[model samples]
Target: MIRHLVLFKLNDGVRRDDPRVVEGVAAFRALGDLIPELRFWECEWNISDRPVAYDFAINSAVEDTDALKRYLEHPAHTAGVALWREFATWVIADYPF
Candidate 1:
């Protein structure tokens, strides 16, 4: 099993109301249904005065590191990358469970 966690900070001028942000968030939430290897998915919006912003986590109970690697290169994920590029910062962590 593996847990993949990520946090994101939008670029200066980007807000929660942005359509791109909304779409990206919805896409991430649908990963468990869209990707077989994604066993669980959850996300949180951070309404704080810190650099760390929204957070997303994925738990893969049936996938190995290789599967995670494939997920990162998957089309859905590629779309996320393209959309998230406008964000200012991103933090990610992956660990075996």
Candidate 2:
């Protein structure tokens, strides 16, 4: 299996409640149902108050590298990324388990 992890930091002055952010979050939340390649999915706002913490996270898994590629190129995933592009920056890591 491969784990696909993402951490997001909201752009300067962008609040979680912003209409765009709200929509982006919803889009990501629905991805598990939309993408068949995902074997696991967990997304949420960060609870930490530490200065270095990211604002949001996505922890997901797929069967392997090919499945991970499919997930990355899926329409729903691409759409969600487009929405987030306006409001956040993120980092991702993928590894086999």
Candidate 3:
């Protein structure tokens, strides 16, 4: 199994209700359909402590490294990137288990 984790540092003045935030969450949830190897997924909007930087984080599990790679490069992911690129900074990691 492989785990894929992503964190997003939102842009200035951005809020959880912003369209970009809404779309980001939806995109991550929708990824399971396009990437069949997604074994499990979770996305959270940061609502506590009010961090100075990020607004949300996403954690996902896949069947293997290859699955992680495919999810990373999927067109749906690319589309999501294009949609939120201007308002977000993201980080990703893949770990085998």
Q: Each prediction's Cα RMSD? A: 2.5, 0.4, 1.9
For model 1 the TM-score comes to 0.79
Candidate 1: RMSD to truth:
2.5
**lDDT string, candidate 1, 20-84, tens digits:** 88887777766667777676666667656655445333334436788788788788877777777
lDDT by residue (1-97, candidate 3, tens digit) is 9888888887778876888778877887777677777798777776766546466777889887677778778899788778778678888777887
lDDT against the true structure, each candidate = 0.70, 0.98, 0.78
Supply the global lDDT for candidate 3: 0.78
Per-prediction count of colliding residue pairs? 0, 0, 0
Clash pairs, candidate 1, are none
Question: Which stretches of model 3 miss by more than 4 angstroms?
Answer: 50-53
Q: Give me the candidate number with maximum lDDT.
A: 2
* Model 2 quality (TM-score): 0.99
Better of 2 and 3 by TM-score: 2
Candidate maximizing TM-score: 2
* Cα lDDT of model 2 by residue, 1-97, tens digit: 9999999999999999999999999999999999999999999999998999999999999999999999999999999999999999999999999
lDDT of 2 at 55: 99
TM-scores of the models, in the order given: 0.79, 0.99, 0.82
Worst 10 residues of 2 by lDDT: 64-73
Sorted on lDDT, best first, the list reads 2, 3, 1
